[model samples]
Target: MTSSDLWDAETAERYDESSAFMFAPDVLDPAVDFLADLAGDGAALELAIGTGRVAIPLAARGVAVIGIELSQPMADQLRRKRSDIPVVVGDMASTAVPGTFSLVYLVWNGLGNLRTQSEQVACFRNAARHLAPGGRFVIELWVPGIRRFPPGQEAVPFHVGAHHVGFDTYDMTTQQGTSHHYRRHPDGSVTYGASNFRYVWPAECDLMAQLAGLELERRVADWTGEPFTTDSESHVSVWRRPEPPSRPLEAPAGA
Candidate 1:
């Protein structure tokens, strides 16, 4: 589906109800903590901060968070949070927001939404543009399942509920995956939600950061800082923006 079809207001509202609970404390808490700690007493920027899932919690922890969102509905949803956070409705690839941040993050496979390698690289550039010197950019994305799905493979399915099921299957050679999300309503109505998109591996993402002049700081399998290995299914990588060109901001004017 097109970007417009996937990210409009109506669709965004339904997102959390559809998918948020799929991940639990194990995933949510560590991810939030990682972002909060990296923020380091400075402001944070969250790209595609859908419904304030992480941003709200981080802000409640007394961190100042600004969100960059593409969908108004998504930003509106975030505004409903009991905790306060600033949000800008704009494109992650092009739109620039004011203020430099110590931490910029894209969570929950948000990087996959960029689709193309160039657009992905543009996201890194945009993050760099908004980052303070020594600021960090954190990304959470899936480890491509290509090695698991050799030629002729079609699907990898898993059961979720007694009635609901989720399947994330990919075509290895084509670089595409169809994530089938399903549910059964109390009224006995069954509905299906699916998104098909391209997938990127961790190494390519490193190159994207390098091309954007950001240096990779760390890579882990999850928010808890599990060491990334060949068996890792998802990755959390951190990148640092280089220090500014001149003397430090805190330096004396005459020096």
Candidate 2:
């Protein structure tokens, strides 16, 4: 069984509509630009690529892009948009795909979906396994929001909107959390949904990269390359595989 929560047909179908704001040019262009620059004529693999939000635009920019998604329904949704982009339905932590990539990325806090430290570490290893020498693995993840909790508090409200209300409840000991959402329909009926995740610290991610034989290259607060500070709520981190050393030239015969 997959460790991650599966997005069923209903979720997949409504995903684009529910997440419309994320598709705005202002919010999306910077991410595409950041990733495209890193891809730089090389292919990229997106872990948990959902509905081609970033992948579609990134591919339109001439970057060869493929995806690994845990949810077949989500993959089907993506296929409806672009048949040319291939997607494999499997667990991102251990799924294997053909060909090495110059860039492998997991965005939108996808790493947290693993829900276990071991799985998350294996995910790093899997990314490293798919990366060519000097290739980079990038992840956009939220820093744990425990700081927002007051003493004895376990829940934090992340969004309080007219049509949608969302909050997260945390278990400090396990570093696990669940984001709960309530969406009101036009008819005034409400729907509820929740997803579980294991929150990870940036330092823990650094160690995971190290264990995967990748070196930390950069860490920014966002796709725009802002400085990462303790107060930052999220981070976009990049780790690179080391390039092979150049061979020394041999001396001329009888030099």
Query: When superposed on Cα atoms, how far off is each prediction in RMSD?
Result: 3.7, 1.1
Candidate 2 residues 1-255, lDDT tens each?
567999999999999999887899888999999999999989999999999999999999999999999999999999999999999999999999999999999999999999999999999999999999999999999998888888888688888988899899988899889999999989999999999999999999999999999999999999989999989999999999999999999999999
TM-score of each: 0.88, 0.97
Off by over 4 Å in 2: none
Q: List the residue pairs that clash in candidate 1.
A: none
Per-residue alpha-carbon lDDT of candidate 1 for residues 186-233, written as tens digits (9 for 90 to 100): 789888877766689888888989988899999999888889998999
Q: What are the lDDT scores of the predictions, listed in order? A: 0.81, 0.95
Candidate 2 matches the true fold with a TM-score of 0.97
* 151 Cα displacement, candidate 1 (Å): 5.0
For candidate 2, list the clashing residue pairs, or say none. Answer: none
Count of clashes, each model: 0, 0
Residue 243, candidate 1: alpha-carbon lDDT: 83
| Top model number, lDDT | 2
